[model samples]
Target: MTLSFFDQFMSPVFMGIPLILLALSLPWILLPNPTLRWLSNRFLALQNSAIGNATQQLFSPINPNGHNWAILLIPLLLFLITLNMLGILPYTFTPTTQLSINLAIATPLWLATVILGMRKQPTIALSHILPMGTPNLLIPILIIIETISLFVRPVALAVRMTANLTAGHLLMQLIATAGFVLMSNMPVIALNICIVLFLLSLLEMAVAMIQAYVFVLLLTLYLQENV
Candidate 1:
């Protein structure tokens, strides 16, 4: 039975039960736990140091009041990165490729930031709806445009990630399928295709990490505007 290229994005199941929960929880389990020792193992220490740097950079632009969310957003970044990288392995499903999952993750966090901004500085938050010195006739038009953009942030976040990952996976599958089909009749060409596939795999790995960073970074910028 031939499967469609999009089949890879399908959520997996066993015995008619969804395995998405297991997939979502696996990243946490794969991460190393913090230990009480004065010095951690080299790998764990490196991990901690890297995460610390990311946390500091992410919070630097935001008002200190917003730093409280570092705890939530940092772990979220790690979770997404882990999920994305893990999905690169054979037979693994990428949850982030699903628009529903991405939207669910993004929308609430985005709304929370908006609410926080409005709560802390109502006047300032409302001011973002329209720019200064606008023509009398243009006021309503600008307000309508700004309102639509404001509400579209989360949807943009969801679609950006989903589209990037889905396209990468689709291209990789197409390349691999072509390479395998050509292997018997055109060995040299198939070998060249394999080399190209290998390079594309590396590019996908980088894309996976970068997309995760961009996802969180955009959220941080949104929080910055609010705080």
Candidate 2:
């Protein structure tokens, strides 16, 4: 029974091909393309406005040179939010819930920022490893610690998103199962559980949006440091 709960996390396969690719592609397919008309529909206008505001806030701390990243970062924020929200729907798979997928997305972008720093200002980038006026005996230890922390950023990003989504999904499943089992013997209790479940679902929806923003926000912070 416990294993059955975990089965939802597994990548579905059909005719020997994993459907993860399909799941990843599904979000973009649902987005409405901007029309050539002078005016856009309310939904498109709102989406554009939100993207602009978020991009402005995200890049505010970054240097002018970093403005170029808006092209990549804005789309990424939308993609993540869409995927997270879609996952909450019944029978839908969330690509971000997989640790490997999240890590794959995070590590390359994080590494790119690190590489940009090294390429643009190697001395400044390397200087982050050791602070000024350190005791000679502690110098080596501090460098090692800082280096480990630097590499751990991407791992933390991946784990944070994966763990949050996984925990929420598990809790929802547990509550749903209890509600189902209680319905026949105790309809009143089952109805209460359903109410709780409904509220919890609303909370999870908020979490889905917040986690996506948090993920993007952290990436922008990292970029700010590097740029």
CA lDDT, every model vs. true structure: 0.94, 0.90
Which residue pairs overlap in candidate 2's backbone? none
Per-residue lDDT tens digits of candidate 1, residues 23-49? 999999999999999988998998999
Q: Give the per-residue lDDT of model 2 (tens digit) for 168-217.
A: 98899999999999999999999999999999999999999888888889
lDDT of 1 at 185: 100
Go through the candidates in order and give the C-alpha RMSD of each one to the true structure.
0.9, 1.4
lDDT of 2 at 94: 89
- TM-score, one value per model: 0.98, 0.96
Model 2 residue runs over 4 Å out of place are 1-3
